[model samples]
Target chain A: MEIALLLIVGGVVVGTFGSLLGLGGGVLLVPLLTLGFNLPLREAVGVSLVCVIVTSGASASVFLDRGVANLRLGMALELFTAIGALLGGTIAFLLDERLVAGLFALVLIYAATTMLRLKPAASEDVATPTGEGPTGAPAPAGRLMAGLSGPNYRVRAPIAGATGGVFAGTLSAILGIGGGLVMVPLMHIAMGVPLRIATATSNLMIGVTASASAIVYLLRGGIDPYAAAPSAVGVFVGAAVGSRLAHRVDVRVLRVLFAGVLAWTAFLMLRRAAGLG
Target chain B: MSASRPGGTLEIRLAQLLRIGTYGAVILVGLGTALMVINGRSPLDVAPPLDPSRLVSDVLGGRPAGFIWLGVLLALATPTARVIAALRAFIRAGEREMTIVAGSILIVIALGVVAGTAGG
Candidate 1:
């Protein structure tokens, strides 16, 4: 009873933070399960992956509705991400758990450091005014359609997106973190996608990518349905709330706090990897 | 070319499908969890191994844990459905490239499910 309650509350908190920050809750959930609950890393990861799916399912729809997510780009990128997830999921069972922890810690540290950087200029600078619009915001003109809306943004360099997808998918599977931490940056910085569009599109792809690996976890006996159920439910509710609150909050403040949390999580993961936790 | 609308018809449908699927799954999982707690069965650290056949049997057998698993299965299926929705939308739009992309993703997901079931 106590464990079930704890997992549900923990998942809600993680999901709120993740949705606010454009992450998918796995980054926080993995460390929480492993360090706070003292579950095995593999089991923790399985639970985290489930949470990621819930977050994706809960949040991506809103993003797509708002016209912030480019579904066409997401679908194109998912092919690579799914392929990478397959390779990573297959390799996960063969690798040492400690190595996985170490890699996850490194990713956390890298993410935190990157978050300290200012917003990318590409989001604001590349304003090719295709037509006049309200607020004088240049309407993006392109043939790359997203759903029924005619064109979203013109996607460039499919090869670059694919390459990034490979890395994102591998990390997502092995570390049980949503690949968005990497994909958002890759799209925004490397592929010249707008930040909002990048995050939303990343959200859209996460479920498919996680599902690719989650199937392996489910079949391989890594998932604990008991742990995952409450967590997933909590995340689903929390993501809905967080998505509503996202616009009101100051993102910079959240970023700073999240970076601190990431740093601390990295330290805890490293400690566990060293057999000290 | 600029977008003709705020959200395309396909995007709206996808959003609606996802919202319904996820929220419904949450309700089912919540009910199942309540049942478990009421029955004095705690799923704390137990990882029950189940195949699809066993899952059906258990659910039909009035097992609360089965409902939980079913909820998860429903949640997982949403993504697959989304891919199919995208494929249909793309084909309708005459986006041959995008239709192929969605189709490829569906194939990958199918392969994963097959391999996972086989391995288990």
Candidate 2:
């Protein structure tokens, strides 16, 4: 009951703020379950995985209908992420909780810095149809579209998308950060995807990434169905509600607010890592 | 022509659907706000012992700043936010790969649950 109650509440936040800010619920939920509830680190991470699955799965359809998510890019990247997730989950089983926590804090700090420095710029509107590797040189031949730029910005996204997917999978299994914060910025700054598009697409990929590891957790018997059930239901409800309002709200403000929260969360995570809090 | 507009055309079709969704969302938001104001609601928290009520009050411009954090999540997690993101993707790239990816993730979730319980 306690887990369900807590997760249901958390579901609302994940469904709302995740879509609003382009992050996965895992980033917040893992830390909260571990520190606030005194759950074992691995178990907390396992639980966070379920939350991400529920919320993203329920909300992604709306994102799909609206066409905000870039499905092909996300999937092409997932083959890498799925591998990363398997490795990360294995590492979680091997790692010391303290080490994981410390890494978590460090990762959070990095994400915060990126968020703070994020510049609102024009969508490149350029599509590279080349199914090729990331190269430093110009996109070859018919693959080149318009480059997204500000004064010092031109991100090669396909490469970053693949790499970021691996990172998110690893983090999800290890520190339980979900890596959405990382994926969003990378997609925007490196891949040149629009912020909203990045966020939507990120959400789309999350369930798949989490599910990859979720199976591992289940096999290990880390999940508590009683807790995961109601929470998943709640997340579905919240995601439904959030999808309806995706357009009316101002997203930049939401980003600013979410970044602030993450900053604070980083502080808390650091404290927990140090056994100071 | 169905009932609400009685005039079948592109304009009415779009407008009617728009109004239903818009008004429905407003009512939902209003209902949530009213519940908070009138019923002494406790905002959602992933783990308690960390007052969400205060956070809600702070974020929504409600009294006492009771639940600022909760308000933040509530505002962020709406279906609207998710839809906007999804819509943007389709418009930008014209693909449904996201749907497959989400499905893949859920399978991992099931695995995690089974593993956690067995391990626990």
Candidate 3:
């Protein structure tokens, strides 16, 4: 009973912040379940994925409607990400959960470090559009680039987007945090998408991307509906509220706090792995 | 090291500092994993709590950690795209910069790989 309440409360916290910062909040979810609720890593990851997908879906919808998310750009990139995800998902089906956790900790460390060092500031004018036709208007012209690839649909720009998605898909399946960690950066740099747009797009796609792998896990009986249900409920609420308030918050400070939490979690995970807990 | 070009030396030092900081963070996490292994501790989180959902995990005893990293990267692609879009929005501010973002994320992935393996 207490655990049930705890899940909701935990979900509220994770969802709310998750929405606000656009974080997968899976980082928060994993430790909360494992350390606080005593769930096995596998179960925790499964539950975490379900919650993450719901929240991401809700958030993504908002961004998509806003026209900030480029469907052509995203879909084009998904080509590579989908393949990468398939391979990664297959690997996940074949690996152990603890090692997954350890890798997660390491990824957090990497993410936080990257976050600290990475300057989202654009360094060049690569966005100079040719003909500058549609200012502040939706240009379906992006669709034209999809087929302009090198011999045939091998366009370099589209490949960058695909690469981003491919990596994001693989990471989501393996880590359960939905792979926004990989997506945000790759899209920003490789594909030349704006950071804000990339995050919004990534959050939007997480549900579908996660669901794709989730299907595999479900078929294999990896999903526990009970755990997924409550988690989904909690995170969905959190994500909704978080998205509404995202712009109002101080992003830099929130990120710092998030990074700190990740570092601390890594410490705890290490302690647990070493039996120090 | 240069007395004449104080600002230039400082800029060089800052770049060096950030890179070192990035690697140092990775190394610390790696060492922790090494310590755990040396202590004969296992890496699996076998039976996580029931309330937290036991659905999607890879089960440590029988799986590889690389799969997890790969999954994380893929699932995050879209949201990461938004974040990049957000970053790229700064391009409108007139100083577009993707290098720092890319470099930072790459460092994280590389570091993540290092620490993840040590614990495994």
Candidate 4:
């Protein structure tokens, strides 16, 4: 009973921070379960996958309702992501836990750097009209790519986006993340998608990407129902609360503090990987 | 482009589906956790290994783990359900390219299932 309460509270904290920071709770969740709760790394990853799915389901709809998520583009890229997730899920079971930990530490360091350097950019950038011909019709780049073009912006370098999708999916499965850090930048920078659309579209793809690998974890008995149940429920509640409070809170200080915490956690994870912890 | 309109019928329907799935899973999982605590089981106890074949039977018997597992399954299924809904919408809209894209995703998920079961 006490442990269940603790897990729920811990999940709420992780969820709140994740939502506020725009990093999905899974990034915090795996570390919490492994370092704080002493759960095995693989099981923690499995549980994190479950939580990521919950977050995605809860938030993706709102983005869709706001017309920020690009559904056609999301679905198109998801094909490659799902494939990569399957491959990564399979590989996760084959790799050493320590190596996974090392990779996770690297991801944490990267996340910390991103958080420290975070800036409030205007979501509505001037659209680069790359794929359109005269008279506002699509250029002869074919119908599929043309269909992916948004009202204000035409998707550019789709091939690069698709390639990034595969990489993001692989890391998501292996590290139990939603891969927003990868997808959001890839879409906004490389694919010419607006920042708002990129974030929303990344949210749309995350659930499906996590689901592909989650099924593998489920089939392999990697997830623990007891831990997953309370944590998932708590995260769902916390995320709802956090997103509601997002616009009101000034997160600059919190982001810096959180980045420091993440760096310290990364150090501990590296030590654990070396059997020094 | 007609089919790709933002906040279109398809997006609305997809949103509704996701909301339902999220709420339903949360309820089931929450209830299952309560049931476990009431039944004198520690939530920290090592969970029994999942047996896919017994999910229905366990749920019918009112096993706490069964409900929890079912909820997890529901959560996992939500995304796939979204994809399926999108695929149907695309097909109904006569979106040939999108239909192919959605169908290919399903195939990929199916392949993942195959690999998982085979490896497990």
Candidate 5:
């Protein structure tokens, strides 16, 4: 009963904020599980991955409907993200728990700093056309460049996007957050994707990226649905609500608060890594 | 409304599929959660590790833990399913490069699943 309550509550909080920030909230959940609940890092990671999928499903579904999600862009980038996730999952099983903890701490700290420095998202230009012509169907592209670039805008940095995707995927699997923490900024800063598009695209891809890692954890018998189920439920619901409320909230304030949480979590993770916990 | 938006039909279909999957998973998981709470103990509470096959069987057998596991699987599968849908849509649209990219992603996912089984 207690565990169920904890998981559900934790999931709701994580899901709400995660959706608001265009993230999976795994970073927050990992620390919560490890410090508050005292679960092993790996177990927490397993649970976090499940919740990540739930959040992804909930938010991305809406983003797609609104045309905020760029499918072509997401698909193009997912190649490297999936590859990285596969490698990350394998390494997680092989690496020392403490090392993973230390790395997770670094991820948290990085997430905090990034959130702190993140500029306000550029204006909402998410309603990009879907390339439906007068005939109400899309035109066929004959070449590789056209296909890769898609119909929205040209992707300026395929190489950079791939590198960022790889980094995001590995960190996502290892840290349990949606790779959006890495992806959103990478797209905005390095790839020159608009902020709204960057976040939407990140949201769309996070699910596929997490799925790759989740399979490895599931096959390894690492994922515990009992621990993850209620949380997943809460997160799904919370993400729905968050998406609705996102526009009303002050993003800067939220980022500051989230950064604080990340900082604290980073401290806890580092403490555990140092064997103090 | 730039020149880079994907085919509208493809995006809509993928979104619809994902939404349906999310709803389905949530409903199943919610039902199982209610049962678990009422029963006062979950199969996963301090239980031994089980693989995907056993988990599916148990879920099919109407066990609460099984339902939860089924839900999680559905949630995980939703995105991969989206990717598959996109791949098909791209192929139908004759976007050869995109088809290859989607196919490669699927292959990677397949490899990950295989690795999980092997590593486990």
Candidate 6:
């Protein structure tokens, strides 16, 4: 009972930071369960997947209702992500536990670096294209490309975005992440999507991405219901609170603190991978 | 860029569906945890293997694990449900391209289920 309470509290902390930093709680939850509660890494991953599903589902609704998420773009990219998630889920059970841990540690380091360098107010004003139509819109492109365009920006380099989606989906399944860290940048930079729309669309996609692999974990009995239940509920609550408070908080300070946490967690994960924890 | 927005209704409906799923999951899972605590069952104990066939019976029998498992499954199903909803909307709107994309996503998820069942 006490342990369940602790798990809930831990999940709240993870979810709060995750929302504030625009991350899935899995990045923090997996480390907490494995290192703090002494759960095996695989079980921790399984639990984190469940938590990720909850957080994504809860937050996605708000993004969608606000009309910030681009459903067509998300669906198009998800075809590739779902395929990659299926492949990664199949591979997860076959890999060595230590190898997975090591991979996760590396991902954590990368995530930390990304967070440390995050510039939320960077240039979002994408320049208009040369071949402008009479109404100042970019020249009509292919059907799919035109469908992906938003009000303020035209999606570019879709092939690159789709390629990145596959990689992000694979990482999401294996590491129990939402892959927002990868997808946001891929959409914003490589695909010419605005950052706000990219983040919202990524939120819309992560639940589907996580669910594709979570089904595998469920079938294999990898998830612990006892651990998953409280943690998921906690994340649902924390995410709601965080999203509400997002505008009031100083995100720059939060980013620095979260990066520090990620770095420390990555070091611990490395130690565990080396059998020294 | 396109002149008019696409899939606006789809987004609103999907949002409602997602909200229902999330809230339902939280309630069911939270109830299950409370029941476990009340029954003196340790939430830290090794969990039983999830048997999909027995899910209905376990829930009927008021097993805490059953509720939790069901809730987890519900959460997993929510996103897939959104895909199905999107596919239906696209088909209704005569969007052949989007329908194809949504259909492809469903196929991928179906294949994932098959792989998991076979591998597990």
For A84-196, candidate 1 gives per-residue lDDT tens digits of 88777777877888888888899999989878784645434253223433345443344443231224344444566799898888888888888989888887665556666
Off by over 4 Å in 6: A120-140, B1-7
Indicate the residue-level lDDT of A72 in model 5: 76
Which 10 successive residues of model 3 chain B have the least lDDT summed? B1-10
What would the per-residue lDDT of candidate 6 be over residues B18-82, giving only the tens digit for each residue?
99998898888998888888878876788777888988898898888889988988999999998
> TM-score of the A chain in candidate 6?
0.91
Clashes, model 5: 8
Sort every candidate by TM-score, greatest first.
Answer: 6, 4, 1, 5, 2, 3
For residues B6-115, could you state the per-residue lDDT of candidate 1 as single tens digits? 36777788988888888877877887777777777665647566567787777787677788888878887888888998788778767777778889998888887776
Which ranges in model 2 have alpha carbons more than 4 Å from their true place? Answer: A1-6, A122-136, A140-157, B1-120
Question: Residues A251-276, candidate 5, lDDT per residue (tens digit)?
Answer: 77888999999898889889999999
Scored against the true structure, residue A47 in model 2 reaches a CA lDDT of 62
Name the weakest run of 10 consecutive residues (lDDT summed) in model 3 chain A: A146-155
lDDT of 6 by residue, A1-277 (tens): 8888888898888877766555778899998988988888888888888888888888778878888778889888978888778888889998888888899899999988877776765424353344353355445488887787877677777777788889988988898888787887778766767666777788788888889988888888788998788788788888777766655678668778988988999999999899988
lDDT of each residue in B22-108, candidate 4, tens digit only: 889888888888888787677668887787798889788878888899899899999999999988888878899999999999998
Off by over 4 Å in 1: A120-153, B1-6
The best candidate by TM-score is 6
Q: Indicate the residue-level lDDT of A131 in model 6.
A: 31
Off by over 4 Å in 3: A120-157, A275-277, B1-120
Task: For model 4, state the Cα shift of residue B68 in Å.
Answer: 0.5
**Arranged by lDDT, best first:** 4, 6, 5, 1, 2, 3
Each model's total of backbone clashes: 4, 81, 96, 0, 8, 0
For each of the candidates, the C-alpha root-mean-square deviation to the true structure, in angstroms, is 4.3, 11.6, 17.6, 3.3, 5.5, 3.3
Tell me the DockQ of each model, to 2 decimals: 0.65, 0.08, 0.02, 0.78, 0.58, 0.72
What is candidate 5's lDDT per residue for B9-111, written digit by digit as tens?
6677787898999899988888778778887875247643655568768767766777787787788899889888878776777777788899999999999
Off by over 4 Å in 5: A120-153, B1-7, B42-44, B51-57
lDDT of each: 0.78, 0.55, 0.53, 0.82, 0.79, 0.81
